[model samples]
Target: MRILIVTNYYEPEEGAAAVIITRLARYLARQGHQVTVLTSAPNYPHGRIHDRYRGRFSLSETRNGVRIISTWLWATPSPRISRKFLSQITFMLTAALRGLTLPRPDVMLVEAAPIFTNLAGVFLSFVKRVPYVLDVHDLWPDHMLTVGAMTERHPAYRAARWLVDHTYRRAAQIIALTPYLEQVIRGYIPGMDKVRTVYSGVDLERFRPGLDDAAFRAKHALGNARIVAYIGTLGTAYDCLTMLETAFHLRDRRDILFVIMGTGTQQQVVRDRLAQGDLPNVRWIEWVKYTEIPQAWAATSIAFWALFNHPLHRGAVGTKMYEALASGVPIAVALEGVVADILRESGAGVSVPFGSVDALSAAIRRLLDDPAYYARCSQNARAYAEQHFDAEKAAQTYEAALLKAA
Candidate 1:
């Protein structure tokens, strides 16, 4: 089937949304489907447009057998609410207009994030007379509210809720990233039979155990130290403060280095705190290319997955955990809900209560001190990824969802 995927994020962005969507597009293309991606130019996390697409309003390219069409957005690195809202609005308009001119496909898979992108998909679905599957990554205004970005009484909050519900009503089908997320969406839109859970799985081929980490370690100036890494967007939903505090508690261990990578709204906050403190064992990397992330994982001895203690974050099983598991690196997570459940069920790592620095620190120390336990967790990590987080299986499930919608 010919498929058109509409997402604000795409290849070269390095964010979880971009990586997941890009991988799915390539997988479909490899399976002999005519896959086309409609997205904004590569500007994410950092929010600065890539050099190649800097001055262009729109551009198109083909990568790995999939066609990628990108349009310009009002990109910025600012944390202000107005700037972000404007960015989304511009992308929503540009993507919809650009998508209208493209050849109609059998199905459109729309990633519903920033919420506005769904407007583009809805417009294209109505105008092109094609079915579109709404891939719901997060519940929008609820997430916004949870992160204290806005209140329920805020006009923007109400507007976002309306837009999300409208998209949910319009789509031929909806894809939730986790089963728990699907349940919550169903609760919001009762009797929503069309929604299905398709996890944001990891590419085992790209991330696996036994990669040479010496080069990675040498390049990072991290000689022979076991790294504990928090590698993803340092977004508002993440408890980065707790991660740092935990690191501070373990600063005496010179052999275990804490590495924080990626960029987001919370990056500056982390930087400011680091500047005010004396955490010699922690290393903060502003950015890392997506291609090098597997090697980053290779150099990591432990993966730190953290989220704020918020109800909205309960269903989120962020892509980093799966990637870590795939790389055979055990996790020390400050998480709840589905992610915490996965850690326990797989015996891949230990989960501490959100924001509990002492517990998190202790968990790390135990994993380091007990070689046999660490080895078991590492083995379980890879086994779990192989059994459940296979990228091929995820792509097939996504394909089935789109086909059903079409």
Candidate 2:
């Protein structure tokens, strides 16, 4: 199959979307499919071009057998509204135009991001008359509304919704990561049979335990403390401020340490709070290489996963949750929707009510009080990740979906 993947974010821009996309693309290519990615230059979180992509123009390259194509576009990577909106539009236009000139693909898989990218993809599919599958990572304009990142009444919100609708109506099939989102999109788009659930996956082998027998602890200064680590984007979407709150709550627990291992819009603010509050049990670290996560996981006694309080959260199944489970670590989550469902059903970890520090405290204490219970959750976590959220399986599902869409 000739597959063309369209996503705004890609390599050098570290996140769940990038990780999953790269994995699927490489796996598909290895399966003997001709896979091509159409993406903007990689600049994410920090909103500037990554070192590899810096001073680079639209270019075609190959990585591990898959064909890589990046187009010139604005990617401000920051949280500034105006510049980000403009970047979205520019990348959409550039990718759409570039995509149009290529040979007609057997299937076009367009990621739903920046919202505008899907709009452009919808347009391109109609113009090219090729079937396009819509991969909904997160509900956009609606997410913006819930996070107070933007107002629902704002023109951008309305415009983004319209684009979302356009893509939905045009898509041959829709893939949603969570059941709540599947229902939401099916409700709004008037679809039923075309939608399927394909979870974002984790590399179970790479994110597994026992990698930190000894070398890892000394390297990261894990010392002797029982570490609770949070590793992922610290964006508004994640609402990680309460992580500090959790740190403060555990201030009296001298043997426990809270380690934050990532950067985002929320990083500095959380850091400032930690500094002013003088929480000696807490430690801060910049974003670690994705490869180093296993060591980080080895250092952690528990893994923390959080999302901002928003209606949009009901549609999210955080990739961090999946990865933590795959790493065989006990999870402490403050999230809603599918994540909560996974925890409850799989017994992978404990979840406090979203945004409640007191609840988070109680949950943390519950796990710490019983080591056997924690180990049970750890076993369940790894078991559930392997059984349900395997990317190897999902990648095959994705291939079949694209073929069907085509």
Candidate 3:
């Protein structure tokens, strides 16, 4: 099978989509399928093109058996909707034009996010007569609305809805990251048989438990303190402010240290809070390369997955959740949805109400003080990952869906 994946994010870009998609593309290529990825030049979380690919219009390279074609896009670090829309639109046009010159695949998988990137796939499907699958990462304008990017009454919201709906109807298959998302899609679209749920699971070898963390801890001056970490993008969808506040609430606890690792648009919130006062027990690490993520997890005693309390988020599960479990680290999730249910079912961690400083602080304290409970959750975390979150298993499921669509 010849597979083409169109996405705004890819390898060398720091984010869940980039890491997961790269893993999937490489896995398909290894499985005897010809895989090619059509993406914008490396620019993500930071939103500036990488130095290596700086002035190029497009560059084609092959890595680990997968062909990668990266095109130019207007990248920005701004959190404003209009700025991001412009970036997505530019990438959509460039990717579509670039994709036309390549050999058409048996089937193409398009990532539907940053909102307009999937338009490239839609354009190619029409021009090249290739069936395309829409990988619905988020529910578009609705997700934008959930994150306060825009209002339902806005003209842009209406326009996005129309475009998104058109793509949904035209797609040969729709891949939802969660079963809840699949149900949500089925509610609106008539012929629901096309929708399927395929998680972007974690690579156990890269994320598994018990790595030597002495160097990591020593380098960071973590110093034997129980680390309660919030690792990953500090985006608007997350309640990072609450996590910081929780750290402040427990600032007096010298044995437990709070670490916020990763950077995003909402990073200013952290800066503002830090500027207001001193938080001796809190350590903030701006960012780290993807390869160092597991070591950060290894140094963690408890992981905090904080999502905003919104109805839309119930259908969402960040890839970090799987990574945390794979690392055999117990999570303190400030969410009550599919992710929270999975945590409860696996006995891997505790879920608290979002934005509650007391509840979050208490959860961390319990996990830290009760060694037996902590040990149990730690064991359960690895067990759950082994049973369900293998990256290879997810790629196989994704491959089957792509083959069926073709």
For each of the candidates, the C-alpha root-mean-square deviation to the true structure, in angstroms, is 1.3, 1.8, 1.3
Error of 3 at 282 (Å): 0.8
Task: Give residue 241's error in model 1 in angstroms.
Answer: 1.4
Ranking by lDDT: 1, 3, 2
Q: Write candidate 2's Cα lDDT for 103-172 as tens digits.
A: 7888899888768777777777788788999999888778777657778788977887887887787788
Off by over 4 Å in 1: none
lDDT on C-alpha atoms for all candidate structures: 0.88, 0.81, 0.87
lDDT of 1 by residue, 1-406 (tens): 9999999988877788888998899989988999999999988776799999998889999989999999999899898877898999999999988998999999999988877888888889899999898898887868778767789899978887887888888888888989887998888789889988887789999999998887778877988889999998888889888999899899999789999988788887799879976999999888888888899999999999578888878888888988999999999988788888999999999998888889999999999999999999999999999999998898898888888888
Return whichever of 1 and 3 wins on lDDT.
Answer: 1
Q: Model 3 TM-score?
A: 0.97
Local error of candidate 2 at residue 225 (angstroms) = 1.2
Q: How high a TM-score does candidate 2 get? A: 0.95
* Native-to-model Cα distance after best TM-score fit, residue 373 in candidate 3, in Å: 0.7
Choose the strongest candidate by lDDT.
1
Off by over 4 Å in 2: none
